[model samples]
Target: MLRAAAATHLRRHIITQRRRIATPESIRAVAVDPSGSLTPRAVDLATLRKTTGAPLRDLLNLDIGERTRRQRRACVLPRDKAVLLQLGGLTAVINADEALFFDNGGEERPRAALRRIGASVEFAFQHYKAPAFELAVLEAVLAEVSSSFQRRRDLYEPVVQKQLREASCEFDGFGVDGLHRLSAFDGALMSFEAETRQALQVLDELLASDEDMLGLLLSERRAGTSVDPERHGVVELLLEAYHRRLSAVAGDVAELRGKVQAATELGRVTIDLNRNNIIKFNLYLSMSAVGLAATTSIAGIFGMNLVSGIEEAPLAFGAVTAGSGLVGAAVVAGFHAAMRSQKSIEQRARHAADDREALTSLLANMATVENVFDDACRDLTRPAIAARLEAATGKKPSEREVEILFDIFDASHNDKISLREARSALHRGDAHPLIT
Candidate 1:
């Protein structure tokens, strides 16, 4: 009885465990026949393996739960004569004769994107009789991806422009509403930029893989393999055409990103300027309050019952009033003077620090020059001087500017500046120091 009871308990536990485990959703795939018929079907792991002839290791990468492993990639399985491509939300397995597309459904449906590919395939079959149907399908996929980017740009580009205009016009009035709007614009642009960059990266990988494959085909043909020139030419043309289109779209995205970044930076600087103004205003208000308090204290001292003989004098009230005004004015003037002194001190300190840094940089550059020339009297040409100045101070002076500066430093009209002359000119306060 005990053994039978234990067996029943074990069966119940197993049933509960099984019920708790969630099953993976089946992947929806479309089978594209060479004859140009589209058959939509549900595929499980086993079925997908049978259809693609991929190993279990490769099939395991298709697990939707393993997101880290599902990065965009092109896996060319020469053994199975197939190419597995994961482009954004769509994964495709293309064989010599047919292709299977698995759509990882999201907010953006793959069906809408695949519709273009389906139509193109049908048209190609009806007219061209499918000379290189697989390559054509790949080209259509690339076109759809490019179109998707263009559509996203169209949807957001106008809104971005409108926001930018509003921001520029209302920049002076950076109230709560303006700030909120700016934040919203920044957030939206950030999301769009990230998505576009990801798409561009995938497209780049695709192009690189395509190039490698084309190179391999050419090499094989060179090795006396019977490769079709027509197919090679078609593949090259399609890849090149889509590459240009995709590159143009990527450039547009990059330009938009740059504009958005610039706008955001400008907004930040404006906000900071306004904040500083508010701080200064508050400081002035505080100084005025201090002066007012001094006058109030004087009046309060006189209002007390304890008084000197001056209270009985005729001019006492006038004198007291005048004295209070002068004391208040003096207090405010003292505050102003102290603030000015503090500002002067800070300015001088900053200038001294900058001078120190410049001097250090100059010394380092002088050492470099000495080591390179092996003689302090070695004359450097105009280009050499420009290169050294750029390396030291990160400012690439123009040819004319360098030429003029070289003349000033050369001092001998020799069309060349010696290291000793350059050092001497930099030390003189009247001369324009290149290190600065």
Candidate 2:
């Protein structure tokens, strides 16, 4: 009896020593959810608005682990759950399996730390890219305007509407349509940033070539500037401004990309629409020909003198004339019937022509606007592509400049410049891009 009692007391003591588990109700519920990637675990960084520490980039690029070692532990509490963060260079992963702090008090493993950090960084990066892209696009556009203003005002033709038209023309992927698509937050922000920087460099060069000229054009809203002041060397001044502006605006590669895409889409849609119209026009043309044939047939019958006998008899002329009148009326009716069909067909053809012309005008106008956007975007990123094109073709300044100018023009290597290209290129760069 004494031994059995002793055994029972020992079992009770062991039970008392066991640690009691603690968890917030919310956390308990999270743990029960089976849909999470971490099937055996659950954590909510988003929920831990107050508890999560700042991004751990400091840990990511560290060649040595010393920096993270020196830093204090980052602890974040999402709702009722806490994340105890330890950094590995470039990652901040969570240790979801830990029910509580490891009782043995071992240092957090670096590998595990990295995975959590990566998850967080990926989240933050995903969030940051779109806003950054938007910001970059705006900056790029501003940069283009700045550079182009400098060119047109300081270096080249400021007064001519054509100059303005040219400056405003272009088509590239990143043009106006590009801006539309830029809201998509991809991790391409870095690429955008890189392209922007390159464009800025080119703009700097162009601006430096004629600072005074650029100053004037860029400040056209000049609180006090005269119209037709007739500055000496105005041609040179305009040239400088054009180059600077083109270089700057063309720097935003994304705009170029957007414009190109927009133009392609615009081209496809417009072409398809136009083609359909052409087919309709042809169908109408066939109808017109058929109507003309019928009209000709009615006129031919009138020429045959089908009721000449009535007109020949003078004594019976009045009655014959009356009968002839009936015959004439029949012929007139046939002519009118044929004429109506012919007229209808002709009218349809005219309408088709008018409709096509209107659509053509509209498409052209849209394309011009697209061109402007494309030109601006291409110019922003001109120098880098210039560099690439240069490298591809041995970097001859003349050759490179041509390639650069072509990019501004947004023309294919084989394609000649359109009025749109001319305007875009002219507005952005030297009006006399060609010496001729």
Candidate 3:
């Protein structure tokens, strides 16, 4: 009797602990019934498994683990008649007649995604008794994902533009704060790009899985049976629409990355150019110091008590002063000339490299043209070439500069420049290329 009583007590304690573990604070969920009414509830993973009738393995897959480390994935189980979507911290599980959302914290209750799904469900209720609700859920999820990405992009793009503008205006005056800000922006951009890419990949996978499931359903149909147009067409159209939307998000991300890269490159070049100027200035200062020291040494020798007889000669002081002055001036002039020549060489080398890169870009762009050519050479007009040059160099050249470049590249005296002529001019290194 004592042992049986102890066992009963233990069983009651275990049930109490389970209840505590499944408290509303730990997990929040909402179920959308066929009637489009939402029933909010609190359920742990164990209760979720029991309610959904999903197997242990499937329920384990829903475990979001550390929210920060969660990966985006979509799992469609045709046999179990369940669709699972995990987007960062949010998880959505859709069954045949009901959809359940599990919020593991971070996002607000009844997320935009959930609201979208709810709206779609309500709309479907008016048309058919049993709509392809899974497609609607998928579409809603994708739309929400795309919308979130766009919002983030909108927030980031303006900041990026503002930073770029500020950096451009004060490029030469960039201090520690400016550099730190640039680094922070770079890190943010990298993180944003990574997240956008992951989101895009998840969308692609979900769409592909949906299509595969559709194909499988079609294959299982009776031979020579006409497929339901509404069922298949709606799925195709929905997927295509989301695909385009997500693709645009991806394109925006790409554009943002390009701008970030340009900003980074500009900062790097500005810093390098400033450092080179400082080094040159220091070199000039050192040369001047050496010349002054040489003149000072001559004056010191004459002032010594045991001076040479030349110091006592008539007009010797004036001659010595003139000679020392001449020597110092000659030394300064020689060093200055040498440094100037070195600077010129560096400038020429950098210009040559930039021209070669611009030529390569022009040729690549012209290669995309199918039939537009003149005398067996792919040619681009002045404005077209100028745009390509700006893209390649990340700096826009003035109209006069573009005109000059076009004249240089147009060896045949034609208004348009050909790829062959640009390439030849850059390779020969004789033509003066436009400095970007």
Candidate 4:
């Protein structure tokens, strides 16, 4: 019985000790006094107000009770001699020498913001030891803004540098793989710009709004004829830092835009060059097809049942077959040469037709430089002839089609008609096909 009683007592003692171990609560409030000392035992809102001598009514402005609707806000209640600041879940009443902090220390809180504010406040307390409410506010805000900008710079600088390096390296040999890399870098840059803008804007608004207030507070404290050096120094430093980061990012974005443009243009140029090569290849294939057709025609004729007397001689069969093949090849070569010569004659005639009109028109004005003007006239007329021929045919005219149109127009020209009138006649002829 005594042993069992002792065991029960030991169990009770263990439970009591566990209860006394004091785990941290979700909601907590702490107060700090003028001598840079932290208060023992977290307090409630009422206790926080009582200890810091700040009015409890200001807590309503913080909107702390509701978790989802919290926002970052800061206001100086000069009449109460206090500053109320709420950044995410952390709210603080910053007085002349003491501060009361209320933190919703839950898992979903803005832990980074809270940590930044805490570290800034602690830094001020440890360094300045007797900083006023304005200095403390400045210290906290500067730390957050400076650290935030620096953090972003560190994070993005390497990425931007890598993108720049890749772009430079790939520029010489930009192709399909380079295009893919550029597209991915473009997307990443867009995301970075979007995310960085929000933070940059917030800090900008804060700095603009509080510049006067900080200046006034520092001026009153220093009683110097000169402007508040501390206010200018810190604010300007942060402003310059943020500005430098923005400039770097903006410059990188512009450079990437240029790179993307050059890459796109290069891709288009390559496509155009490839298309021209394909068109040239197809033209060669057409010429080869014409040659092959000639050879096939000769072969088909000899394969027929009708026989020549040469079939009776032993060497006649070989000689006739060989002669037929050679004749087919010779026909193809003659046809190609004839076509080429015709193309050249038509081109010359087209140029001469253009120059004839221009030379006639310029003859009355320019007597001395007729030779120089003749060459210029020829170049200008060549394209005009091609255009008119195309319009009259209602299709891209081949060498044969162009020659047919030229002959059709020649009669109109003989009748003392203008080129446009000849073109109209040809167009009418093409439009009105023969019933047969």
Q: Which candidate has the top score in lDDT? A: 3
lDDT of 3 at 320: 83
lDDT of each residue in 327-435, candidate 4, tens digit only: 9999999999999999997887676555433323222111111112111222223345445434422334344323432343345444332334342432322121111
lDDT of 1 by residue, 257-316 (tens): 677677777778887888999999999999999999999999898778776788899999
Rank ordering of all candidates by lDDT, starting from the highest: 3, 1, 4, 2
lDDT of 1 at 226: 65
Model 2: ten consecutive residues of lowest lDDT: 27-36
Rank by TM-score (best first)? 3, 1, 4, 2
Estimate the lDDT of model 4: 0.48
User: What are the lDDT scores of the predictions, listed in order?
Assistant: 0.57, 0.36, 0.58, 0.48
**C-alpha lDDT (0 to 100) for residue 309 of candidate 1:** 86
TM-scores for the candidates = 0.56, 0.20, 0.56, 0.37
The digit string of per-residue lDDT tens for model 3 on 1-436 reads: 9999999999986675555446523466788765666778665666656655567556555653213333344444433346666653357777656677775533333333455557667777767665556655665566666665564555456546666677677775653124434555566566656766666565565456655545323222323565554455556566678668767867876787687677778888888888999999999999999999999999888768665688669999899899999999999999999999999978876764554454333322221111122112246887775665554334565565555455455789879776666545434232322211
Clashing pairs in 4: none
Model 3 CA deviation exceeding 4 Å by range: 1-26, 51-58, 65-79, 106-113, 127-130, 172-176, 206-212, 215-234, 306-436
